[model samples]
Target: MAMHTLIKEKGISGINVHDWTVLSHKTSILNSQEIDNATNELGIPIPEMIFGNNFLSIEHKSGFKLEFKALPALAMVDQSSKSSDLIKVSYAREWFEKRSMANQEHITDVVKPYDWTYSTKYNGTNLSTDKSLVFSPTTSESIDIEQLKKPDPILFYDENILFEDELADNGTAVLTTKVRVMPSCFFILLRFFLRVDDVLFRIYDTRIYHRFGTNTVIRECSTRESSYRETRSRIPRSKGGDLSLLLDSNWVSSQLPEKESQVEVLTLSQA
Candidate 1:
């Protein structure tokens, strides 16, 4: 599918709007010779014996938008009966309503859009948290791949989230690499139900774009849009390698929220 369809041409509204998903692919174990062939195909100098090494190549994509909207609540009256819970109802409604009405003036000035891009060689380990740890070029070094260690669960890769905005400047692009072990495998010899023989390498990219006219006072909107494209490449194992690995190269759409509905942006008012 096209990014425009997933994100929509008009765009959505809200302080935070983005789409994230994981793509899985079929894989095969590569020998030294095979690794060289695949490396040449990729056109980039990848680690030798790609499967033997602990680190796996990765690519991840994340995109979102921030939209500010005006919300007006006119003439709100308390209609609750004289019950214990009724006392706070009026106050609560008035507080939120008034706050929403006040935010209409400076929403644009306060919310600025951002993007992130950071990349480096990453160590793959089975840690408690699924968070990415980035290493600068100066500190990039290979570690003993626990994936190659015997018996004790070979964690080929770990799932992680990179909190770039939490620790960097606006419009910064964060790029990171990580790998995960896929349960499926194809053995050239035995061809039995195997473990982490096949793995998927990914590169994730997240970006935030501001919608036009949102910086103005008269406009109000908030929504999320997403689009995805995937390609499946079948790799040669031992024999029967002549068979095509290409499954399908197509984009798919998601069933998110409806397009016509309106979303409200809520915030606390100091006044």
Candidate 2:
């Protein structure tokens, strides 16, 4: 397949932070037996065995292409955190000042090295080496309000409901107000810090939604109904864990569908 470039669009605003530790080349934790133990415990399956020189060719339906190198012994922390007041202000200033520069640079178009992995459903299960990261730059040709959907409650109230007509007409009217629940949205950016033994690596991911988009709004929409529904939690570790390091079938499955369907049919027939 022809290699495609990944572009990250500019003027996209968000916040995230992370720290990571990289493992040394001679780390014992990376031994075959140790990796196998982790995979077995996690119930992960190995799908395609890749060599050191193989490049994962990623193509987006939107006509973008990505090629990246997968590195070993890297750690990543992908999370969102509150930024310092001064840092926030400086970021805003930098954003405005570099808006044009960002547009021209089109960071999304650059293809960087990404560590890739697959989820158990796809029959691949390794933790450290199984996790993959891809840096694709995206462009926003138009404002995507849908991207800003958030899960929060919004309240609106009236300011002038309690004052009499005489008092309201004579001076500034005093009004009573109540909270009105509405939909709201917000965006979150995650910075993954990978820790492999003693070495660290960093990767970034962004989750975005509307400023006033709320869970209520998501529930009301048929398209977002599934999001409101609950499901079994798969996270094994809640603290000090690298979610990005976990296998992601969605990423791999998205890439090689033609072969996957054939394999699925065969498995179903045997079952």
TM-score of each: 0.17, 0.17
User: Which lDDT tens digits does candidate 1 get at residues 100-180?
Assistant: 665643322222221011122122221212233222222222222342242432223332222121112211212222232
Candidates' C-alpha lDDT: 0.22, 0.22
Error of 1 at 91 (Å): 27
Residues 115-180, model 2: lDDT tens digits: 221201111112322122222233322223454344344322111111111211211111111112
What TM-score does candidate 1 reach? 0.17
RMSD of each: 27.8, 26.3
Cα lDDT for residue 18, candidate 2: 12
